[model samples]
Target: MFGWHVPAPDQAMLISGGKSRGEAGLPFRIVTGHGAFVVPVMRRVTYLTLSLMESVIEEACVTQQGIGLAVKGVIAFKVGSDQASIAAAAQRFLADQDRMSVLTGQIFAGHLRSIVGSMTVEDIIRERQKLAEQVLEASKLEMANLGLVVDSLQIQSIDDRGSGYINSLAAPHQAAIQQAAKIAQAQADQAAAEAQQASAQKQSEFARATAVKQAEYQSEIDQAQATAQQSGPLAEAKAQQAVLEEQAKVAAKNAELREAELVAEVVKPAQAEAERIRLLAQADADRTKLSAQASAAEGRIALDQAIIAQLPQMMQAAADGLANANLTILNGTDGLNDAVAQLAAQGSTILQTVMQGLAAHHDVGQQGGAGDRTDPPALGPGPDDDAAR
Candidate 1:
């Protein structure tokens, strides 16, 4: 209705309890003044008031530092209590719920996205004091543009979940380094054990070879000693046998020399002496036989002479004896004949005795005389003495 009538700057309207002056692009107010004529028109004054509990759901932007954030929390603003600005805000912005509630929410959302997009989470967490002031300043301009005067601005909290995501990416590389170190240590231990085993095997082989060589050398020495021990006695026995054979040959030579000297010196002389002795014995035996015969004849002649003389005597006596016998026979014929036969036998016996005595005496003298017969002389070749005869 006020748009239809024009009021001069000097015009007065009733408000509160008195008349007040007028201005364009401002809310009308009632006023009191001195006597002036009233004019009638097709315009009237209207009044509006708001309760204390009414709130405008609008956004306010805040930039936080050190607590760097990409999402924001709740922000709140209220209209001021100043009457002049209140009247102006109510007239321009309070006409409908769409501009005050919906349109204001959209504008605040844009401001918050714009400010937070360029910041990090660390910037918001470290800069809390600076962030509260920035929210108040930005809310003042936004509220005025919506024909509202800001009474108070506040910042609640900033959200931070982006910081934890960055630290998770680097964990896998650290685990791989620890695994590689353990594998290298195991390989070094295995190499050391193999080297020790090889050294032990080589030492054992050398010791075994040395022991075998020593044993072979000892065996050869023992064989040589045994050969020397056996050979010495065999050589000594052969030398003794040779000496005995040579002694036997020398004794045989001595016996042959003794036999040859006997034949030359003694045997020939003994045989010649034996032959001369035999010749001398034959000559002596012949001489002795001739001498014996001559002596025997002489002794026989002497005995015959004596016998003849005795025979003459014997004949005479015999005659005388025979005559005596005949005379007796005449006395006794038988006695006489016996006496004659006895006398004839006695005569014949005496004659035979005389002849045998002569032969015996001849033999006695040829041998030797009766005195020489006791020991006869050696008859054969009386030494060499008969050689002269």
Candidate 2:
């Protein structure tokens, strides 16, 4: 605990006044990352920081054009990791180590002014990164003398000292930027307006198309409705027509049946009846003709018998006439003549009587129907019959 010394990762322990050659042949022995033991009061130990350090440089500089400017920059430096660099850093800044930033800032400020004096305002502003790189490069050698290494240098700012040189240089670029911004804004506005107008036109066309489609649908619906409305009556009319047709057919069939009935009930019977009456009339006509022929024959027979019955009467009349009249015959001829005349008279009388009797019988027959006609009576006895008895 008394002589044991340890250094932090970022620290270097410098042990002086009785040390071995700890490399680089320095008067002190440096310990880092481990411990070293020493004799009591004989070795003096000092710790130097090996961590990074930052220094700010602010300097008044002149450009190559002789324009005066104020320049500000930062320098980042650290003690080197080697023993010789650590020993060198310890000899210079180990008593008051925070003064490392002050010395490094002073050194970087002088170098920054000198570098700015070699360049113009345009190079300092436009090539600020290159300026910082060059300045860091230049300080690499100089910082290595103090056992330090520069990690980076940044130019914080440069002022024109109110000379208006930087403003004059940048005026044209600022105005061009403003003009470009305005042009971009105008193009964007035009594009937005065109898009809005196109949207409005599309909406209008959609509305019109919707209206047309609705109208077409409505028309179709109306036509369908009309057809539906008429269907009831049309169906009824058709039904009634069908009914009427059926009725007519039935009526026509009834008429045909009635005609057949008339033929069966009336025409057939009427024809049969007419034929019966005609047959009876024909039979009666034939019977009446036969009766008339029989009656005529009976009349002729009665006339013949009546003529024979009247012959004797007519001869008596003739004999009377002979007695009353004169008749002569010479010799026997006179007698013969009388007798012959008498016979001739007798024959003529008989003929005349036959004709008269026949006429009388015909008259009687004509007065009665054949059913009422009587046969002639048998022959009656006459005066001649009495003479014969």
Candidate 3:
């Protein structure tokens, strides 16, 4: 393990001298790809680092326009990883690996000068990529010979050494660009201002419309609330009206019932009573008339009987008186018969007068009795009865 050595990933290890020093032989080998290897005694091992690095080149060179321009640039390079590139780099930088960046910088500087000499100052400043590309192309073979790969070349800066030629050359275009930028900025500001004004106007209009709508809605809400507030009373009024109407109907019904009851209880009974009284009065009148007629017939029969009884008594009396007086038949048969007949006629006339007087007295008594009595009197004896007996 004393002769065993390992190389880093970015390194190539070279083994030399199996029998001779600083020589390539059977024992000499290049080790890469990061692993351990054997190094025999009396052999040398050299490790070459393969890593990316940069070099800076600053050179004052005269342009094709005869202007002294200082060109500053950077070159990114690395040691090549191929066997041939490693072998070539190992031969050149075997003992001095730190000299690679210095030599690369010098080489890029010489090429940068050559490239700047070929182009104008404007080309070196404005077309820095063209300058870098041309420099890269010129330095390519030289870097490859030294086992280096140039990854990129960039021109960092170009100076005109305080001469105002570059500024003078750029003045017109810079002024034009500044004018165009100012115009663009003014236009943008105008557009922004107009947009802000429009936005403000729109917001104001929206606010006004919203306020109006809210006012209208509030008014409607108030009206609805008022209507709701009045609804209870209105309903109560309607209910009261209905109640009153029902009461009126009941009262009317009561009045009708009362009228009907009066007709039944008072008017009908009174009418019946009046009809009964009229019937009784009519019956009494009829009874009175019949009783009067019966009394009149009875009186007539009594008078006739009285007159017949008195006629017999009077005839006997007259016969007695004539026998006591004297001979009264002067002319015998004819005169005597005429005197008797005259007496008989005079008796008949006096009987008629007495019957008339009795009839008148009976009528007067009947009238006096009727005037004194509420009921009809019963038929009894006549006034001429005592005289006739």
Best by lDDT: 2
Give lDDT tens digits, candidate 2, residues 1-389.
97777889999998888646566677878889999897778878789999999998889999999999999988889999988789889989999899989999988887788888999999999999988887777777778889998888889899999999998888877778778888888888888888888888889988999999999999999988998889889989999999999999999999999999999999999999999999999999888867776777776776677657766765665555556556565669777777867568656765766467656766666556566555554433455643432
User: Distance from true position, residue 101, model 3, in Å?
Assistant: 1.0
How far off is model 2, as Cα RMSD? 23.5
Question: Highest TM-score among the candidates is held by which one?
Answer: 2
Reference-based lDDT, each prediction: 0.51, 0.82, 0.79
lDDT of 3 by residue, 206-244 (tens): 999999999999999999999989988998999999999
Instruction: Give the Cα-based TM-score of candidate 1 against the true structure.
Output: 0.28
- Between prediction 2 and prediction 3, the one with superior TM-score is 2
Residue 379 of model 2 has an lDDT of 37
lDDT of 2 at 29: 81
**Residue 192 in model 3: shift from native, Å?**
4.1
What lDDT score goes with residue 339 in model 3?
81
Q: Per-residue alpha-carbon lDDT of model 1 for 1-389, expressed as tens digits?
A: 42333333333332221243344434345332333323334234433233222233233323334433444444444434445545555565444523454554455556555555445444545665555456556666767654454444344555444554223333454456556666766776777677777777777777787788778778777877776677668657767767777776776776677666665666665666667777777776666677567556655565566666566556556656465442534558888677667666765677677658667656765677433422221122234322322
Error of 3 at 24 (Å): 9.1
Question: Model 2: which residue pairs collide?
Answer: 329-334
lDDT of 2 at 301: 71
